[model samples]
Target: MELSSFLLAVIEDLGADLDPPTRYTRYVNALVAALPGNACALLKMEGKALKPLAVHGLTPDSLGRRFELSEHPRLNAIVTYRGVTHFPNKSTLPDPYDGLLEGVHAGDLNVHDCMGCALHVNGKLWGAITLDSLRAGVFDARVERAMAMFARLGEAVVNVAGLSESAAAWRPDTLNVKDLGMLEAVQLARHDMIGDSDAMHTLKREIQTVSRSQLAVLVHGETGVGKELVAQALHAMSDRANLPLVVINCAALPDQLIESELFGHVKGAFSGADNNRQGKFEMANGGTLFLDEVGELSASAQAKLLRVLQSGQVQRVGSDREHQVDVRIVAASNRDLAAEVKAGRFRADLYHRLCVYPLHIPPLRERGDDVVLLAGYFLEQNRSRLGLRNLRLGRGCEAALKHYSWPGNVRELEHTLGRAALKARRDGLGAMVTVELEHLDLLSELPTQACAVINSVNNAARMSMPMGEVSYREAIDGFSKNLIQRVLVETQGNRAAAARQLGLDSGNFHRMLKRLELL
Candidate 1:
């Protein structure tokens, strides 16, 4: 096809109401068809690297890799010149696609010729498009000019798609609640953070604002509220999006290894340390390091961490040499770090450093109708995972979900929906599976006599009627334990089901079991 015809086709595709991925895929495919090359790829400039948006004649794994401008000289040259860049067959610069092409040997680097042009939109360098060949001199002056023209058209299509996505993300203030819900559903699917509530909007705005800076970010939230997702969104929206996002769970690491994990260790630093190794900080150089459950770090570890944050230098265990690292820190904690600092458990200096920009994620119970929106998102995921033709919520299920106090937050809701979907499928509710209230087993969660019993106990100092010499408080405790045990037996040891049956949130149910010495 002619370059003009292909460009027109891409423009038409962009004009449609397609998703971002689909629009990018169609545009790249058209570019490959018009260009003279064995392989072509479209990469978007993100932070200090170029991220692959779409590709032709390359391995799928290439999509997962980012080409940092500092690491690829030829690609950097292309972006800098903002024009056609042609590399001769004998060019010494390394090819980013050295072994990525299909049918190429895993260790071979035989790409003979390559050319690329920087993609600019509205006077800013947005990305680049490249063409590669196995034969030399394929990208002559005429071919270079033709590719440049296509790159201009490609940039226009990309800009339009971006605008469309942004427009779909938010509806006008005039939109009704139902219309807003529909718009939010589309936006939620495309984004990692899922909600349209005011609290969610405020959190998203904070993420966008903080992402533009280099300061440390502290994400505070309750357990299971998706602190990691917040960290991910922060990194993805930041200028360092294309760089590594190294994550370390402080709560999961052993005290003895925390230092080594964060600051590396030289060979023989300790038993079993056979070779020198880089730690999370070095690995995340020029990127982001997400420290999850930061409140769990030991006092000594916190001291070392504070030093790194202050100096931007990490010293290996048992080594005197310090390596400079350029890493952004994003820490998350369920605990109140301020309280920990006041209690002398956490270092005050470290707490202040991480809290330079704090973001709090709202609990699921407070998000109102966002529960229904999230349910739809998880339902669709379950449908695709289970290979079911359709999966949806039945009557009253949405109300039940929103009404229940989700003490376990977003994580709990996701698991509940997943388990319910599986149960529905197993119960012979084939292709068209609608998750009924019964499927959720939440009828037992209706307000029961337990509340009334507690109220009566609170009102009276002592019950006139005592059971077998036990005090009123003891009697009530025994009765609650027996009721929970019976429910557990009925549910065959499914604590979540038993909790729902006993009119309790799963977190509260667990706490009750712990108090009764039954957990």
Candidate 2:
């Protein structure tokens, strides 16, 4: 086939409606067939590293390895040089895929002539397409010209894919928003919760039951478990949904400012008070006031809050006048307020007032398969943000996500997926990008206990187990406690370090330690 016809055919295949992995496979297969080489691979540039996107002649493990540009001068030369970089068969620099080629023995390091052309999109260096040949001087002037044309065609295909993805992402049917009644709003709010686990269903039922009442609610959960989302859902379903939902982070304000923040301060109340200011309670009159991290409130502020909850009245700072405010309270805390009350750190009256209708959100680990569902949701959000046609989780990625414990919960999952998608895009996997196991970068985030548990499960599956057994729940609890103990020992009594090593937030880690009697 003519060079132009071959290039056209490659572009057509790239534009075909296929998933990311398949599309990438086809692109590399076509490149090797059209170029004067026995093997070819497409690599995306991520920061200073070159990550393999698709390969025709390399082992699958190559996709898991990231080749740093600074560490590999040969690969660096390919991206740095404008035209094709032809490496001699006897080049001193080691090949990134020296032992990674198909049929290559473990100890054998075969040296092959190689040529690479950097693929650029919108005048920016996006990635590279490289070819390897056993025959010396296979890439002559004609081959170089053909390779350059192919790179240009590849860029055009990527641009088109990006445009197509952007168009599909904002399709009218996907984003159609209409006027919603109170009933419709409640239904929509439930859908926004984003999980199908029994825990989620129970929480939804509780929200529904409480939304119709006037009782104060205390949302209890680990940090990043979407406490604020629960508050929003409660407000959305309540009769006060039309009124403003005032939010305040008790932990974010200083002890001295807590009272002033919750109650209006007179003009001469304190140093910074230049004018009379309405507090959250006043702002949320006849509405809902969401007090996040309410356990962080000081003793004085707790007393004032308890009084207001009981009497529906707020007394402004430095003023004799008392204000009547009918505000529904929705408080959240990662800390156990009941324990805090017993420990004399929190006021008992305040704790009792807030715990009137306590609702506990389940941690991410307890919600099986929900992790994958949430991952898919976050991936689509990212794909839309990055103007990519499709973002898919690779098979191994799905398994890893399901197996790993999410210490940071939904918030962490969202951030992790967003970062992974950006990294994938940076690597030049435009349009349809598949989030592979390597893309997740979850090693640092996996808790020590969780990692051990995952590894142990894998190992145990490979070997025969003892006949003696306990219930699955009991066995899991025992395994978890043991893992925690091991991690605590490794950290040498440093709870914070142990928490990080286990990929858990400090608060959750401390709770786990206490629960396991390791504290």
TM-score of each: 0.53, 0.52
Model 1, range 89-193, lDDT digits (tens) per residue? Answer: 889886776545644432234547988989888898989998888777777888888888888877887888667756765644222333333333333324235
Candidate 2 local lDDT, 278-301, one digit each (tens): 999999999999999999988887
The best candidate by TM-score is 1
Q: What shift in Å separates residue 235 of candidate 1 from its native position after superposition? A: 1.1
State each model's C-alpha RMSD to the native: 21.4, 15.8
Q: For candidate 1, which ten residues in a row score worst on lDDT?
A: 173-182
Q: Model 1, which residues run further than 4 Å from truth?
A: 1-192, 446-519
lDDT of 1 at 3: 75
lDDT of 2: 0.72
Query: Over 4 Å off in model 2, which ranges?
Result: 1-192, 443-519
- The pairs that clash in candidate 2 are 165-389, 447-502, 447-503, 448-502
Model 2 weakest 10-residue run by lDDT: 174-183
